[model samples]
Target: MEVKKAIIPVAGLGTRFLPATKSMPKEMLPIIDKPVIHFVVEEALASGIDDIIFVTGRSKRSIEDYFDGSPELEMHLKQHKKHDLLEKVQDIASLADIHYIRQKEPKGLGDAILRAEKHVGDEPFAVLLGDDIVVNEQPCTRQLIDIYQKYGRSTIAVKEVPKEKISSYGIIKGKPLDHSLYVLEDIVEKPDVDKAPSNIGAIGRYVFTPEIFNCIKETSSGVGNEIQLTDGIRNLNRSQKVYGYKFNGTRYDTGDKVEYVKAIINFALNNENMKDNILEYLQDVLASKNNA
Candidate 1:
């Protein structure tokens, strides 16, 4: 079965970004000019995904509006002869067949994904977390989808984080299925440094079989009194095969304040319009700091 749908969970109340996110969705926060969520959607589109199900919440109306047609803005751009900008704005809505389901409460990732059950029906689907932005020569979700095609099972994207940082993510323990793949034995969510099973931490991309919905339905709430997607995936592992892929990419954890700022700086410095000026400004800041 070809994977044609993707679910993006963007309903989290980003408390980490406090005052800014208090009014705006963290997914709306810009990396440079484009919002972070746009990159996730762009990746899904690049990977041949036709339908996108955004599991969103109340304050995330901006996300919906961002992808919908901005008639007034488009008219203004057209009047100003800004053809390039107008096309860019118009392309957002044209990217995919976007559907939305409101996650009524701030539940866990599992709950967010479950919200898309009706939209997904019985098809295999991809899940991409809005908080993690992955930049690669090939899309991260595409990498997992390819693995799913080859193995005829679910696949999760993994990357080796520092041992000390393993406690921050769902750590996996598994032997190599090949150079870039692992047959996962178990997954430990937020394990302590000493208790961590392995340094291979789960990234944002996932390709899941339809059987996953069954596991999610039966899954009990784990930590934080919330249904964790990790727990559901672990349950799915028992009855079916779940593999992990060490995806090739640079993942930015935009949910973190420091990382968000770093992403802004990195993306800004790489922009065609701002690269030289931004690099010069950065060099000046560094030189002045040393002189001081």
Candidate 2:
């Protein structure tokens, strides 16, 4: 079956971002010109997902409004003859068939996804975490969808992180099926580096069969007193086969301050309007730092 629906969990309290996120959602923070969630939605749209279910919490109204039509702003832009900017704004509102649901509580990723059970029905669907932005010729979610189509089972995107950073991710031990493809044998959530099964860590992109909802329900709360999605996926794997694909992409964890800054600089460096100026500015900064 074609995966036409996606669930994005954006209910997290952006504690890391503190005062900046106190009044605004971290997902609404801009990378360069566009907000983080904008890129996520664009990825889903590019990956053939037309239906988007966002599991939101309090203070997330801005997210909904960002994607909704702004008549006043549209009129102003149109009157100013800013056709290019007006078209972009119009495109965002009509980007997809978007729906919102509240998590009600600060549950983990598993619970955030479970809120979409009714909307997703019994079909296979994709889950894209709003915090991670992946750049590639092929969308990351689409890569996992392609794997699910071939295997007829659940699939998750994986990438090799450095061993030192293993504990920060859900590490997976898989039996190699093909180059960059593996039949997942085990998955551990945030294990110590010395105890980690492998360096391959699961990223935020997932394509799951409906059976995962049941597994999540059966899963008990683990780390941080919240139901972990990694645990749910591990349980689901026990009942049925699950595959992991080492996706080809550059993934930015925008939730981290350093990574968020890196994403901004990297994106700006590639942007046509900002590339030359940013390049010269960065060169001067580097030169100044060296002289100091």
Candidate 3:
């Protein structure tokens, strides 16, 4: 009940990052210097969720000008005094309370989260998928918003994917109530490793339960014809119970170009100003490929 709105959905047309997302908006593609949707809106503002709701489309206006408010790059960093880079560009326009809508075409992701059903009316929201980054020390959307605030229902953030990548996602099958929880009965979308139903996939975080916008307006189109948020969470798990936690961790699908160059070499080897010059430039490119 306290999930103060989220719903990222950045209206995908990335076409697997073609032509540099042909005019930018692949969540403003970046990793080493922030902009994989700014670490997914800083993991929904570090999980207290300050009401975001992006759901955009059509070349995404440079993700609404990278969280707006630059004011001539803050008067050219205050006329070059650069007050610590103008307080980090005025703290990305005061970080939260953002809002956008669009989604007029490129349909999928359940019609871009049904364009935030009138700014998430019935609440209990949170979606997060800006091509997933999930680096977690507890903010994989706050570990499914703390299992949807101790079991009030719709939660999902699953992991364990390797049955040949379980046909690339939405797999859940459920039963175990706690070794990292799961209650779902079934959710298939993308299944095929001989009709998958178990290698537990479902990623890009979620929390749902605005009765999932009437189960995504009674889901219909699927597999590329679109409207498939895992078939509207399998019609909100046939009227109620749906859960899946498994989260703890290191997602980074970054819309894959080999996982976006391994999330830019794991965020430039955990950047403390580029970790020892990227670990001595990755040990001189692995000792010049082991002496060629």
Quantify all predictions' global Cα lDDT against the true fold.
Answer: 0.92, 0.95, 0.86
User: Considering TM-score, which of the candidate structures 1 and 3 is the better prediction for this target?
Assistant: 1
lDDT of 3: 0.86
The model with the greatest lDDT is: 2
**Looking at model 2, how many pairs of residues clash?**
0
Q: Encode model 2's per-residue lDDT on 172-236: one tens digit a residue.
A: 99999988999999999999988999999999999999999999999999888899999999999
Clashing pairs in 1: none
Cα lDDT tens digits for candidate 1, 170-255? 99988897888999899988899988888999988999999898898888887778889999899999998899999998899999
User: Residue by residue across 270-291, what tens digits does model 3's lDDT show?
Assistant: 8788889888989999999999
Order of quality (TM-score): 2, 1, 3
Error of 1 at 194 (Å): 1.3
Residue-level error in angstroms, candidate 3, position 161:
0.9
Candidate of highest TM-score: 2
How many angstroms is residue 35 displaced in model 2 relative to the true structure, after the best TM-score fit? 0.2
Give the least accurate 10-residue stretch of model 2, judged by summed lDDT: 161-170
